[model samples]
Target: MMYTVIDIETTGQGNKITEIAIFKFDGEKVIDEFTSLVNPETYIPEYITALTGIDNSMVAEAPTFREIASSILEITKDCVFVAHNVNFDYNIIRNEFKAIGLEFTRKKLCTIRLSRKLIPGHRSYSLGKLCAALNIPIEGRHRARGDAQATVTLFQRIIDTDNSEKVFAEFLRRTSKEATLPPHLPSDIFNGIPNAPGVYYFKNKKGKIIYIGKAKDLKKRVLGHFYDKTDKELNLCRETADIDYELSGSELIALLMEDAGIKQHYPEYNVASKRNPRAYGIFTYQDRMGINHLAYNILKNAPSPFITFFNITDCRTYLEKICVQFELCPKYCHLQEGVQQCSHYKIHTCRGVCINKESVKNYNLRVEQAISFTSEISSNKIIKKPGRHPDEEGFVLVKNGIYLGFGFVENTEQIINTEDLEHFLIRQKDNVDIQRILKRQLITS
Candidate 1:
């Protein structure tokens, strides 16, 4: 079988190809070679120039990708594309072809994966490092032709390794995911992911979680990331080297787990729920005249808040609703400030408490009633769901309107009350995002 060992230099941010090289090998011998510097038609970043030593001035007079496209297509036709990190080179070429309204498809192989299979026990599989350990000299480290040529030598060595024929066949099988997975990711790690509801963590080489996602089918969802050609997905896949997961037993629990993981890790790729939102609280205070007043403030200053809200609008809206419902004065609820007597345009059910038309004892009773009503609305509850496995049950615990967390209990365990669940409850912080997730589930259930 013919294989085209390839390498490319690209503008990092935009990923526009700046240079490419291809060496066609006929199993035992290098039969043909192609190399070119292409004008990327975009500004190359300083870091890329520093790495590859190929700058704007160097490529200014060179042919554009369109000019060399035909050469690339002709040289690589009917050959299995080979590269150190094959997906990076292959996808970039595919994307370039797509931009020009063409399709570039080929069965591909990653020398990095192959080396791990055939050579084994290497500290690293990067082209330069692998070559250094093998004593294979690379004339130019970052330049396309030099890297491609070195890759050709490495490919030839991989072909000659013992049991290479069987290894190659397995990797080349149509059912194999060897070519589709991220270069640094192990096939076994992906293969081990179960097709069940869970939260998955994508970690970089240093074992730091970079992204977290929840899915009803963990395997399918993680595979979808590899198929996505969007720039963000591509970048995310490129950096992922390991994966970790927690079975959630159900979608609701998966979502909760995902939120908690993202909040805890503050992963680089997780844009939402990474920062703590400002919290507003509804609280009550007793005045000198023996009247109880309802108010809202930032949580830090709100002593013993009756309820919490993430934004001023929601807090004020809830307060307004309770004010009108309980016939409490808007002035005391803090809906309108600097008013001697409550004269709220929307809330006219003040009962004259603001101007002492109503007795303090009567108004205080109404305020207490409103507080009790709020508590009743946010009562302690448990949402039961399917557990991670048979004979077990999953449940989300909410105590006094705050989400405690999710937990699993065996079939024989009897849960009679909120206190009964505390032993199995995995406590979690309540936040705006978590509230939003639970609200949707509560609404649906």
Candidate 2:
């Protein structure tokens, strides 16, 4: 097998390649070699100079990357690119090529991954540390030629072992899928996603979650990503190493699970997750004359609110709509301020609790009716929704005005009574976010 072992020294700031070394090997021996310093067209930091010992003065007279791009491509033609951390070097080269309006792609093998598989259990997998642990002699340390030579020796060791060919075959088989993977991903992570309701997580290679989302059909949502073609979506696809998911039996469960996961993980790409939870609430309290008043407030330790909202504007807008729908008094509901009778009452839109034209008892009852769907004091109820299977029925149990949890009942006998239903329920913690999702589902249903 033909392989081009490469190492590069950069400005350590951007995609600038200052010096590079390449050794073309054909299994048993090195057939050719190339080494050069290229002007990076940028200042080299003092610390980087101290490490690689390649000062700005050294590259000042060398060929620029644009001048040598053709030669670099010519030498590596039809050869597998081999490097310690292949992604870094490969990306740098590809990006530099892109600047000159050229597209570049090549089969690659990372020695870091290979070493971990063939020579396991090292304290550190860094190039310098690995070479030292293996007792391989390295000259010039951070210099391109020195590191490239060490990598060559390491490659030779893997080849010299009795099981070397088998290991190479296995490595090829394992990483074959990775060749087509997006630059930001690890493998064919999209393959296993199911076409079901759920929450999905996007994680980088180290398993750090960076994005979270939910969908009624997970496979379609994930596939939608590939067709988006937006810069953000492209960046997400590039960095995503894997896709993790939880299958929910119903849309309500998916919505609740997504909110909980986003709150817990605070994923970088989930804009809503980074914001405060349930920013606004629709609250109700009894006035002095025994009238129930409804108002909107910033959500903070407000217990048993009627409904929650991410925006105060939405809460106020919904409140107005509810007032009109239920013929509620605007003054008593706090939608109109500091008046004997609200404008709605004069216009005959409100029932007139503002001036006591409507009795307090009747006005309070209307307020209760307005928010009955989401009222904290509503009677115990069951919200029946579609289940995972056609014969099964999913149900949310609210016991004594508190949301108990949800479950799927296989038959009428399984849900004959609350006591019988508890046997199949998956108990869930009650929180404002979950309550909002539950109430919204109930109201819409």
Candidate 3:
């Protein structure tokens, strides 16, 4: 492969390249070189000068990136552009070209990643650090031309040290060209993706979305579908045509995006919760004598709102357990046959309420307590919980220290309005899953 071993001296964190250089190579040997100093529109930070010795005066007479970009691209046209941190240099070049209305796409390679692979043991791998450790001389250290030349030599040494077969094997796997993607993807799509925490989308060449997924480790999870570890993942990966993603501030946002994304994209791999299925929520209502009872009821059709549910068995199971725990009559709760004194009454477990052996007032109190367990009788305030990042924010809603549900908000202003508090609350089917998770979290927190 034609290799353009390149380097750039940039403007600090802004990363705008002030100087660029490329040592063109045929196979493993350097054949030619190109280097230039660009007149950046911004002031060169002092630290950058101390590091690279390229002061403003030195670059005053040099041709700018716009002046040399065409020639630079011409020289490196057929080459695999190689650098220490390929992304930094490549993105800078691409951005510069893009600013001039040119689209620059190239095959890229990172010496840092390559060294980490080829040279298994190294305390540090910074260009300067590695040069010192490996005995490569640095003429200009941080200057683009000097750094590019040094990197070329370093690449040569790396090639000689590692067997060509071994290097090629891993190289082949690493490059977008050589590796097989998930069966559903277009070639090399995973190339454009970043290894950040985010939600991802899969699309075909036609740009039709096929799937959506989220990951704490985006690259690995997207790559995992192709793994041989589990047949399931392999099969799932096979059907994935293209992958796309959004970087979330944290895993929480990734999950939120994932939840909304799957619904939007409607990926076939997704199995659970298809666009909010109407859960047959279990509900409770006060009858003639004011006894609380459990029954299958339309969650949205209730006279008053009731707890939502997903687990059909647990819907009934949960309410029955609550009734039993609170000594509510199964008959009054509509869980037993006929109102002629429940089985609980015969077994002395009903407190004689069903048979009127117990006062209506006493039974009514217990009934109220049990119904209150599942009903949303009040809506005074909603509190959202914060995320786990540094700039990350969470909230707790308390009216007279009465804890409402913990919710999440983006910023301070969002938390000011009660709408933010209520809106951010994740609307889960008031199923046993939600009750269980929330109960445990709220109690523990």
Q: TM-score: which candidate is best?
A: 1
In TM-score terms, candidate 1 sits at: 0.78
Pairs with steric clashes in candidate 1: none
Worst lDDT run of 10 residues, candidate 2, spans 178-187
The weakest ten consecutive residues by lDDT in model 1 span 436-445
Off by over 4 Å in 1: 273-377
What ranges in model 3 sit over 4 Å off? 172-445
Candidate-wise lDDT, in order: 0.89, 0.76, 0.65
For residues 1-445, could you state the per-residue lDDT of candidate 2 as single tens digits?
7999999989877648999999999977889999999899999999899988889899999999899999889889998888886766777788789888888878887777667556777766678899999999999899999999999999887677677677667656644543333444433467688898878998986789988989999978876765454446655665676789987767887776787788788887877644545577778888778888888777785457767676556666667777777887777667778877788533357756777678888888878787775563345777777776677777788876567777777855534677888898888766666666755654445
Q: What is the alpha-carbon lDDT for the whole of candidate 2?
A: 0.76
* Residue 105 lDDT, candidate 2, scale 0-100: 75
Clashes of each: 0, 2, 15
Ranking by lDDT: 1, 2, 3
| TM-score on alpha carbons, each prediction | 0.78, 0.57, 0.46
Q: Report the alpha-carbon TM-score of model 3 versus the true structure.
A: 0.46
Those runs of model 2 whose alpha carbons end farther than 4 Å from true positions after fitting are 9-19, 36-64, 116-129, 140-143, 160-175, 179-255, 258-308, 311-413, 416-445
